[model samples]
Target: MKTQKLTLTVVMVAILVVMAYIPAIPLGPVPLTIQNIGVMLAGAILGWRNGLLAIIIWLLMAALGLPVLTGGSGGIAPFFGATAGYIWAYPVAALFIGLSLQALTRFNRVNFVTILLTIIVFGVILIDLSGAVGLHITTNMPLPKALIFQLTFIPGDIVKSIVATILTLTLRQRFTALSHA
Candidate 1:
């Protein structure tokens, strides 16, 4: 079980790294990257604790100057930039999604679609809120403006959430052990 957890954690970190390398859609300070998809999946598949660990690992590597963020940017500097809020929110979002799904799974009353929707909704809310807060703090931007600007990413986030949901569900069905873990 421990081995499985470690393996999955590493896999999630790898996914984040790979996703980070994908070209981002330049939009103001926060470029849209598919990295959030990996974050969502990490929580859904690895559970909250492990998912958070994976994200932490990835962030640490990036902080150490590895090119693990969008557009191959790295170092501790980005964490203090305008988009830092979104970057820091990844693990929290993953943990929220994972915990929500785990709790829902305990009930066994929710269907897969319901579970997926719940995770995505919570994940989006948490991620956006944290990102907005971070942006406001770092840039001295007004909260309302930061939140409004965040709206621009909603459509893309929804799409990523859907993809993460489908992929998580499919993988969960195929790997019952990992899902339960």
Candidate 2:
């Protein structure tokens, strides 16, 4: 179990790293990337503890100057920049998704639609809130304006949540180990 967990954690970190290399669509100071999809998958598939660990590992690497963030950007500087909120929120979002799924599973209510909605809600609430807060603080923009600015990310985030849900459910069906306890 330990070995499997370690391997899975490494795989999740790799997924984040790979996703980071994908070109981002820049909109103002924030850029949209598919890295969140990897974060969602880590949580939904690996559960909270392991998923959080994977994200932490990836973040640490990025902080060490590895190109493990969107558009191949990394370093601790990004963590203190406008997009810092989104980066900081990754683990929290993953943990929320994992915990929610685990609870749902306990009651045998883990349906595709349910998981999809849960991911969307959690992603929007957690990631957006954190990202907006970070933007507002770093740029000294008003909170409302920062939130409005985040609206541009909604469509992409929704699509990523949907994809993450489908992929997670499909993978869960094939891998019993993915089912959270």
Candidate 3:
């Protein structure tokens, strides 16, 4: 069981790396990257703890100067940038998302609505909030302006949440590791 969990975590990390390699649409401070889907799926499919570990591993790699984050940009520099909050929030979002998924699974209520809501709140909304905070701090932007700017993140996040929900539903059925959660 431990081996399976570790293997799944590694696989999820690899998936995240692949997602990051996909070109990102650079829009203002935060670029639009499909990598958020990987973060959401990490928690939704791997369970909370394992998902968090995988995210941390990915972050550590990026911090070590590996081009693992979106846009092939990596280093400790991004951590102090306006997008840092969003980056930092990935593991946190994954933790909560995984927890929500686990609860739903335990109650046999892991449907589209439940999973979508989980991803929307924990994955999308949470990251939005964190990104806004990062903008506020790094750029000294007003909170209201920061929030307004963060509105740009919504459409993509919604799409990512939907994709995550569909992927979670399918993976939970076919993957025993996810099914247990």
Better of 1 and 3 by TM-score: 3
All candidates: CA RMSD (Å):
2.4, 2.4, 2.2
The best candidate in terms of lDDT? 3
Model 1 scores worst on lDDT over the 10 consecutive residues at 109-118
Q: TM-score for all predictions?
A: 0.91, 0.94, 0.94
Candidate 3 lDDT, 1-181, residue by residue in tens = 5887899999999999888889998888778889989999999989999999999999999999998988787999989897888998999999999999888888998899999999999999899999999999998989899999888879988988998889888877777665576
After superposition, candidate 1 runs with Cα above 4 Å error: 177-181
Between the candidate structures 1 and 2, which one is better when assessed by lDDT?
2
- Give per-residue CA lDDT, model 1, range 1-181, as digits (tens): 5987899899989989988889999888678788888888888889989988999899999999999888788999999998788788888888887888888789874466875686667667778888889889998889999999889988888888788888887877878865577
Alpha-carbon deviation at 73 in model 2, angstroms: 1.5
Native-referenced Cα lDDT, model 2: 0.89
Worst 10 residues of 3 by lDDT: 172-181
What is candidate 2's lDDT per residue for 11-40, written digit by digit as tens? Answer: 999999999888998898888889988988
Q: 45 in model 2: Cα distance from truth in Å?
A: 0.6
